[model samples]
Target chain A: MFKIAVEMLMHDKTKFLGLLIGVAFTAFLVTFAMGYFAGFMTRGFALVSENSSAKVWVMDPAVSSAEATINMSDSSLDSVRGVAGVEYATPLYLGDVTARYANGHFQSFQTIGVDDATLSGSPQPANLLHIPNSVIIDSGGTEGKLQTPLSKKDVWSYDGSHLQAPTRELRYGDVMLINSKRVVVAGVSHTIPRFPPRPLLYTTTSNFKRLIAGEKRYITFIMVRPVKNITPKELAKRISQKTHLKAITSDDFKKETVMWFMINSEDVGDMVNMVVLAMLVGFGVTGVMLYMFTYENLKQYAVLKAMGASAKQLGDMIFTQVFISAVVGSGIGIGIASLLAQIISSPTFPFRMMWFAPLIGFFGVIIVSMTAAFISLRPIKNMEPAIVFKL
Target chain B: MSKIIASCKDIIKTFNSGEAEVKALQGITLDVYENELLMLVGPSGCGKTTFVSVLSGLLSFNSGVCKLMGENISAMNDDELTTFRGKNIGFVFQAFNLLPSLSAIENVALPLTVASRKRAEILTLASEMLEAVGLSGKEDVKPSGLSGGEQQKVAIARALVHNPKFIICDEPTSSLDHKSGEIVMELLQKIIKEKGASMIVVTHDNRIYKYADRIVHMEDGKIIKVAS
Candidate 1:
């Protein structure tokens, strides 16, 4: 009987292909939406996620997340370090700075200032990030080439009107002006981009203070490490209670960042809306296609009924057809989505295909297919075997 | 004399369209005996199809006693009727209504498959039945690829493959030419006689009248005459 159902579907090749395409598109939309949402969530907390060495973050009492925080007084770092269950604390400088390339192209960049001595909170290797007047640019942030004087030994000279160096290293030796002060690119740091889409750069806290003259005595956050036996949550509690400042564990800070993004960012809300709309469109296409296919085969169902097939048998046949289509369609859809994910492999694009996303699409297709089967099998249930004789 | 395999006592069926009511079968009373080929002949819109439908338990009559193999069909619920019909009655349609997706053997094996029979057993029996119907080389051919005569032969094989005690064929030869119709009628008679099974065939093709043991004439939803 299941063979009969499969054979019937195969006999109508045009309709069968139409059904597969419908299901495949539905799967593609569903999986793509899920993957996009996942990528957005990861991007929303990139700052907290990349600073993995910090167990707790101390900031102004009014701050909600790492991205939307007021710069706390530099004295707060000493207060945080003095609290029990806190091993050490370092000032973290975070702000935006505009950089003018030697080529006259200017771009806005998000800058993170790590402790000069400890190199804590830096997104790159300590040796590369701790160098004076040196900065690390995010790989995905720059638009085009950043030309600089060719230099290898970090020495500079002038030849008439041109800047001269002993070596020619294009991206590594790039020189740019930050706040009208010359800065050299030490290396490129491959890191995830945060929201607002600004290029990210990392430098020493001393250099950050030097670049921004008026913002000398303030810091955005104090990165703290808990004692050997104490957890981040316990240390955060102690710090918050002692210093009267907001102290969030790294994990909690990640959640806070994502929550702040969802509540504050219009782009996050728009991505969620897009996901819902994709689901609606997928469900609609699958439902209508399955219903129309079953309706077209109603006469054959009547013939089967007239041949002494019970309603259960007929119903089972319809279910078998829908189930096969759903499974096959999901497979093709996921395959296509994965291929797309691979092709659009640019780090700048927020597209990440999680392993569980395809499972969500699979279950969604099953539900839609089952709904279609139930609705389409209604005519078979009420069919009279005598109808075939009249036909 | 043969014992009666099916009997209809004053069976009545009516079709309602809004306030208009049409009687399709008006108190049809008939008896089909064992091992005999009874042909019900009538013009279009007569009660011939309706009577056979009721007798085969495919349709419900308003007020009548319809029995097959000594069991009252009206007493059985829809499910029971379906199982009873599947086990005891076989049907042939005017259009040679074989499933286009299936080959001839698979079409013939439908009844057994519906009964939850094993695939191996069903295929063997279906192949034998197709061979018995003189379609030995056409077992693997789909109905779409076969001619009208071959398709009709496949339908007949399907009807008899289950070894039902009674068979009802509605205009079984109407879609075939004279030579094909004669061949099909002869095949049906030979198979039914060999199995000692009774058959009631509804058709307007008078060329195959010689194949019937008794011919029943109907008009305006009522039986008019009987000839032997």
Candidate 2:
């Protein structure tokens, strides 16, 4: 019976293609839309990487996934340093720093100042972060970076004019512009580099203390890293009580970043709408095409019945055919969609797809195909074998 | 002679539509013996097809008891009747109505699939039956690709694959030319003898009548003559 169903689909490659392409496109749209949703939810807290090494992040007392970032007591830094198993503690002042672009325009930025330490500074700027002019930006961060180090004398110009920047074989002396406070490309790291406020810039704690025009000098976020004996959560709880501040470990901080992203904007809704539309298109086209297929095969069903085939057997045949279509179509569809998602991973859409979405899509298309098969079943389920005998 | 496999004892069938009524069969009595090849001939609108349908448990008469394999046809419910028909009876249609989507072998295996037994066994049996019907190596070919004679052979193969006790054929070769019709008739006669299954065929083609062991002639739903 399965062989027969396979033969039926194989005999009409054009019809199967139509069904497959239709289903594949629908799946692509749904998965790509999911990528956007995931991207949006994670972007809001790009600070997770920035504040990562800080095992204990001490935030404002009113801190939550849905609240505005506030100031922490400057005195809380020493108390955190004295905490048990406390190797390094820093009064990480995260603030909005506006960079005057070459075009004489200032863009708001997320800036942080960490006391020059080894094990407990931000991962994005652990080394040379204390330098006067050095920073890390996503390869695809501002201008969407290329992850390879390209060598051309013309590539490393005075200004940001290198199509393929000679990011290698250059020292802080050759790459740095200490006069204008610029951290030139001394090394090109091939990673999903972190950026703050959609773009990033790094400078020394001294420069940050002097450059931040505000007189209050109260830190926005306090950071600490656990030594050999201390756990991150315990440190955070101690900070929370001592400073009357909200404390989150790196893991909790990551969740907060994701949570803030999810509930803070309409981006999630857009992604949801996109998936809803894909499913809608999937179901709609599946209904029309599968219905036509059912209509085309109705006479064949009648003939089978006339030959002593039972109604249940006939139904199973129809279901088997549709089920095969669904499996093949959805499999090809998801495979193509995954390849596409990988090809388009950039600043425009940042997402790490879970196994769940594709798995769900696979099962989802099968159910949809079954429903589509059943949608066209009005004639088949109610097929009258007596008619063929009449003729 | 063996006992009757099917007996239509004074079967009566009527059709009533609102204010008008039509009687297709009245007071028809016949006993179909085991392994007998019976040809029922009648003009259009005669009760030849209806009688075969009732005997196959595919139809029910308005009055009278039609016993098939000793089970009263009228007394069985729809599911029970279907079961009895599927297990004990086979049919060959005039149109050679094989499912276009299924290959010749798959069509032949359909009855066993409907009975929901082991599928691989049914496929093997269906292949052998098709081979017996003179359609060797055409098992994987769909009905559309088959010749008229080949399609008819597939229908016959489907009928006999289930190993039924009785085969009900409605104009088995009505659509075929004289040569093709004779081939189909010969196959049916050969299977009836070998399988010990009785058959009642309805056809106007007398060129193939030599294959019938008994011929029952009718016109306007009334039996005019019976010859052996």
| Best-performing candidate as measured by DockQ | 1
Relative to the true structure, how large is the alpha-carbon lDDT of every model? 0.85, 0.69
Residue-pair clashes per prediction, in order, are 0, 3
State residue B215's C-alpha deviation in candidate 1, in Å. 3.0
- iRMSD (1 decimal) for each model: 1.1, 2.8
Mind giving the per-residue lDDT tens digits that candidate 1 earns over A114-169? 88898887765668865569998874334443344443333333233233333332
Chain A accuracy as TM-score for every candidate: 0.81, 0.73
Residues B33-119 of candidate 2 have per-residue lDDT tens digits of: 999999998788888887776667665678888898898878997557667777888888888777776788888888887777697
True contacts kept of 1: 0.66
Q: Model 1: per-residue lDDT, tens digit, B1-228?
A: 889999889988998889999999888899999998999999999988888878888778899898899999999998899889888988889987799999999999998988889889998999999999889989889998999999999999999889999999999888888889889999999999999999999989888889999999999999999998
